[model samples]
Target: MTTLPTLTLRDGLTMPQLGFGVFQVPDDQAQQAVESALEAGYRSIDTAMIYGNEHGVGRALAASGIAREDLFVTTKLWIDDHGRGAARPALEASLERLGLASVDLYLIHWPAPATDVYLQTWQGFEDLRAAGLTRGIGVSNFLPEHLDRVVGLGGAVPAVNQIELHPALQNRETVAANAALGIATEAWSPLAQGAVLGEAPVVEAAAAHGVSAAQVVLRWHLQHGNIVIPKSVTPARIAANLDVLDFTLSEAEMAAIDALDRGQRTGPHPAEFNG
Candidate 1:
């Protein structure tokens, strides 16, 4: 099994650069999928309270017999739970569902600017970390403005910013902002739901490397230094996603994929969404 590379977060924690994501995976099915991923050498698992599959993830973790210290579990607080008193309980509920004492990382799932409470939610995250409920805290789908506000609060800066990033949606501005603020950038929907896999750059690179187009894209993300989580239910696909550690993409190859960005987004826009 290939050991995935690790990222040093600003919070002084090491995170697996490539992890497994359970976004749309149903609650009942998440256990099997996550078990396959762990069996395939995945140590990091990204889930959310809104996903409603934390219990299934907990089952897989327990059944795998992997030591608690060896796993890095990250769950998010949903938009509905973005406030002072709400975040702590939301994470407590998540921990109960995950059957764990504390999560490695907890994130504000979305900024939801209309709600005007993410600032409070972020502050609450700091408190959770102090209480040992989470090892680190971050935000997902947050824009540059949201990040600025979070930083302006004079609290702990976020550890990472997980966003919708793929070949078609590079999110360069936010990525640069994260770097400027010393926050690692994590990418969800890394392959664009297989929407960009068939592109000429991805397909050609796959053929050149004798790997799948998905692997090429994953490699591109890795070279760009983005923490990427690619989700798959199939056992073979789950394993294949982790196989990216064996190969490297050239600067030209990386540039070719970089040219494929078209500002496309598969998820909701961060600014307009309140829930």
Candidate 2:
């Protein structure tokens, strides 16, 4: 079994650097997919209320019989639940769906900057953390300016910032900004939804490493110090994704992939996305 490396958050909590993501996974299939991931040695599971699969994920966790302490579960507060008053109830509803006493981390799903309530939402996150509803709190799809505001005025620095990052869309500036603030940078779409795998540079690196292009890209994420959550419902792919820890990407190979960035994004822009 491959043991994934853990990244310690600014709050001192540890998370598996390579984990499983359940985005776009249907509610009925989430349980089985998550079970496969857990069986493949993935200890961290990322989900969101918007995904509408929390109950299924919780079912898988309950059925796996895995010790609660050994698993790291993360769920996000949806865009509809952005206000300070709505935060706790939203999290509580997620907890109910997840059938867990508390999640490992809770993140604001998006900055929804146009709404102008993320600061209040951040405060709610802080309050939840203090109340023990979540071991740690963070934000997702948040730009540097959003992070700056939340940290500067919200009275707490986020422990993590989950964003869409891949070889083709490195978002280096956001990653650097998070690094400067001691926030863990987490890559949500680390493979670019299969875009990077077909890139010439990625293919060459995979051939040289005797690994799959997916592995090459995932390894690149690890080498670059970004926590990655690659989504796959296929058992073989799920297992293969976790196998990235075995190979090391050379400096030249890393740079070649870095050059592939064309600023393409598969997800919505943080600053402009109100939902």
Which candidate leads in lDDT? 1
lDDT of 2: 0.93
Q: List ranges where model 2 is wrong by over 4 Å.
A: none
The alpha-carbon RMSD values of the candidates against the true structure, listed in the order shown, are 0.6, 0.7
Q: Which ten residues in a row have the lowest lDDT in candidate 2?
A: 147-156
Structural similarity to truth (TM-score) of each candidate: 0.99, 0.99
lDDT string for model 2 (1-275, tens) is 67789999989999999999999999999999999999999999999999999999999999999999999999999889998889999999999999999999999999998899999889888889999999999999988898889878838899999999998898988998999999999999899989778998899998998999999999999998999999999999999999987679889999999999999999889989987
Model 1, TM vs. native: 0.99
**Candidate 2 at residue 153, lDDT?**
85
lDDT of each residue in 1-275, candidate 1, tens digit only: 67789999998999999999999999999999999999999999999999989999999999999999999999999988989889999999999999999999999999989889999898899999999999999999999999999999999999999999999999999999999999999999999999999999899999999999999999998999999999999999999999987888888888899999999999999988888
